[model samples]
Target chain A: MVKAKIYVQLKASVLDPQGKAVTTSLHAIGYERVADTRISKYIEIIFDETDLAAVDTQVHSICDKLLANPNTEHYHFELETME
Target chain B: MRVSVITFPGSNCDQDALEVFETRGHTVHSIWHKDTDLQNPDLVILPGGFSYGDYLRCGALARFSPIVKEVVAHAQRGGYLWGICNGFQILTETGLLPGTLLMNNTLQFICQHQYIRIETANTPYTHGLRVGTALDIPIAHKEGNYFIDEPGLRELQDQDRIVFRYCDADGNIAPGTNPNGALDDIAGICNTTRNILGMMPHPERAATDSVSSNDGKQIFRALEDYFTTRA
Candidate 1:
């Protein structure tokens, strides 16, 4: 089995509305120094595979083809063999 | 054509998306998020709303929904998908779409008639739109601002993968015109193939002239037009 963890985020050029809102609320509550607030997701996948490299490619392809939109998203994966 | 609008428990736009599809002469199905069977539709849409009450962040919890499992499978087979607002967030959560929708730079619950520029109109969803044209769509969200890393955004821009940018009515680059303060006024985007389009604006809300600026109709028209041409 191979386990892969994925991190996904919006591109920098796009505005992060939710993060900004949270920051605003913080400011309203007197936490005025909060410079930034951005949101993101962490995805973990475990699948059985014989070839680690092949599964690694599969993980990336999954992220590329479906998991993440390369245009507006950035995805990084950490893959390791499961004991 | 058949279109399925996914209904998450907190989803607010399922009906809106369905209504637009119906208006366009396509059969629209309201598929709940709990159902595993996709029923094999021509297209699937994740409508906007606060799914799972936006627990663990917007669209994050819904990414593990029963339906998303099947949605991922269908996408693997080259299925077409679309996401708007929270729907776009869910797609990001499920790793089906690209980019993360972060907090707005200014942090406000903005509800405004925003603008979007068509950077690339080649995809099935954007095919009918002319290059460099603009769409005046309404964007109502608390977390519609979009963000990505430097290298990643540059790659998309370099490949013309950057499809839609937020713009003024005249479609010029100006601050404050961007409702969410997105970098480059990016309001929407698509995958490399353009099969999947995720945007912040509510095209369904503006599909009718009576209620809106009528710019929303063009997005639906573009998708339907492309579907017709290919099918």
Candidate 2:
């Protein structure tokens, strides 16, 4: 089995309101060194296929089609093969 | 005119849109999201709702609905398509419209009467309205902040695709008046062909005087006038 871990996040130029609120709370709790915070989504998918190259292509297509909005978000993935 | 309002699994405003069009003496139909046919609608509306329980993203999953193919085809043929609130998000998701709707800056679901100024009166949606005319409409959504890249924003501006902008009662556009912190205070926009419109405000909810203001009626009236003139 092959497992893929994907991380989706808003682009640097796009504003992240939830992340900003978290940063504010962190400061209030005495974490003054925290200058920025951004929230992102982590997704994991398992595939039965063993071909790494083919899986890579499918993962990229899935990310572009459903996992992320290209207009505001970007994503990257890492694949691990498990026997 | 024949109008069709699409009802997704969680859509709550489908009836409201139908009622508004019916009251205006137009034939209205409720189309299910799974249905592949638009039934030859003169105007198609994607109403506001939390389709697919808003899983993953606001309109991401809903875009994959079976009916979306027909909706896209309708727009490609220059048919009138209007999306309201959640519908606006779906339009952006389907790539039928530019830009995306992000979570509100306040991180809260804002529901209230919002004043939006007509940015351009050239489109069929705002045909009879004058620029800077303020219409009191209600907006209810958590992810209504519109975002577009720099070049896309420039294209929209240069092509006059921006249809409405959030503004004060006096028609002044400012940060304080922007309910969702949409870039440039944008409340609504249309496609380059000017046949498709996506807006966060719910004009149907304010279409009657008893609801608050009947300013929303002007939009329907303008659309009716456009069709009449064309006929």
Off by over 4 Å in 2: none
Q: Name every residue pair that clashes in candidate 2.
A: none
How high is each candidate's interface RMSD, in Å?
6.0, 0.4
Top lDDT hit? 2
Give the whole-model CA lDDT for all candidates, comma-separated: 0.79, 0.94
Give the candidate number with the greatest DockQ.
Answer: 2
What does the lDDT come to for candidate 1? 0.79
Q: Which ten residues in a row have the lowest lDDT in candidate 2 chain B?
A: B208-217
Instruction: Give the TM-scores of the predictions, in the order they appear.
Output: 0.75, 0.98
lDDT of 1 by residue, B60-173 (tens): 778778999888777777778888999888776676655677667656678888888888877877786887787888888887767667776787788777778887778776
What digit string (tens of lDDT, one per residue) describes model 2 on residues B3-70? 99999989989999999999889999999999998989999999998988989998899899999999
- TM-score of candidate 2 relative to the true fold: 0.98
Candidate 2: residue A13 Cα off by (Å): 0.9
Candidate 2, after superposition: displacement of residue B155 in Å?
0.8
